[model samples]
Target: MSSMKKRMIKGMVRWSVLPADCILNSCIINIYKEGDYIPPHIDHHDFVRPFCIFMSKGNIIFGKEIYFVGLSEFRGSVTIPLPVGSVLILKGNGADLAKHYIPRVPWHKVLVTLRRMDHSKIPYGFQSDLELEELRLYEL
Candidate 1:
């Protein structure tokens, strides 16, 4: 599918859950090629909550590509083998507070991929219009 079409789909997901006062801020859907991986890093954005949904899976090694380096760091790194239909719910602090990356494993290095299903596509009456913009400003 085209990137824009994909983006629109992602946007629909985002808008569906957005609060009435929030704006349909930022939505991203990423695809990682085989042998490709995202480096360990933290999100440098201002968002109340940041959530991710695994749309598809292609040999993934979760939690192996992260190193906590702050007060909120977890005791140890987590290596979860995420399967299709799995949902990863993360708060802004949880996602941004710690550093994470795709680990380099001997077996394929695990291609990590997921889509952001934001909350901004609900019909009227689901939430207040004012809250929509407020909610969208932060990570969904």
Candidate 2:
């Protein structure tokens, strides 16, 4: 609908696995300081399409399993070392069936997240100039 939306959608279609018709109505930028952690949970929002997490700095360990005693035990859970400029896309089986979280970051971290929103969930007064052309320069 908006110029930014059009650009992002076009970029995703060309550069990512996002469907050609996928429509992302919103984007989120998150910053996490050292010692920060997000509890594991399912992102079952209907408006949200497959989410993408792009790391700008620091390292993180994703996917912590929940223990019976009401705690996170990342014993054998896969640990992904996200160096700066790493992008992790969440989709398909892993996105729908499992919960994932980032444990405390050893250093500051920044995340650029894009979420495709259904019409009803689009945030009001949101606008951006997403440079679709830049997608061509990015190494997928």
Candidate 3:
């Protein structure tokens, strides 16, 4: 495994944001330029609860019902400023009921999202990573 990933997993487990046994087999990298915004929506159920690690400064808005003001803008119950390298773990009502979105970012931003795919939802022809399969925070 990459040293960076190792460090991140360690930090997450140490902070109790993620349990030691959580196996993250899927990853998505999102890069947003200035003026870019993401619409509010819940993550597909194909994967388990996902967590996002911010690579740049930005704000994420979350609410049970997200209202759009216009393209690139929105209104939500709360707006939270996420610092660089901050990790946001989504679960329960926050992950399944509430929708989340990013307002137009003032500058470039990058986010790394990690999740464990549901066993039955994994696409055919996909090969599992043995290393990641056995990875645990306690073993790091």
**Superposition TM-score, candidate 2 onto the true structure:** 0.66
Highest TM-score among the candidates is held by which one?
A: 3
Model 3 agreement with the true structure over 16-71: per-residue lDDT tens digits = 67875666667778998888888998988887775545557788899999887876
The order by descending TM-score is 3, 2, 1
Alpha-carbon runs more than 4 Å astray in model 2: 1-11, 57-65, 68-76, 123-140
Task: Assess every candidate by TM-score.
Answer: 0.44, 0.66, 0.85
| Model 1 collision count | 32
The CA lDDT at 61 in model 3 is 92
Clash count, one per candidate: 32, 0, 0
lDDT of each: 0.43, 0.60, 0.77
At residue 127, candidate 2 shows an lDDT of 55
Model 1 misplaced regions, further than 4 Å = 1-24, 58-76, 104-140
TM-score of 1: 0.44
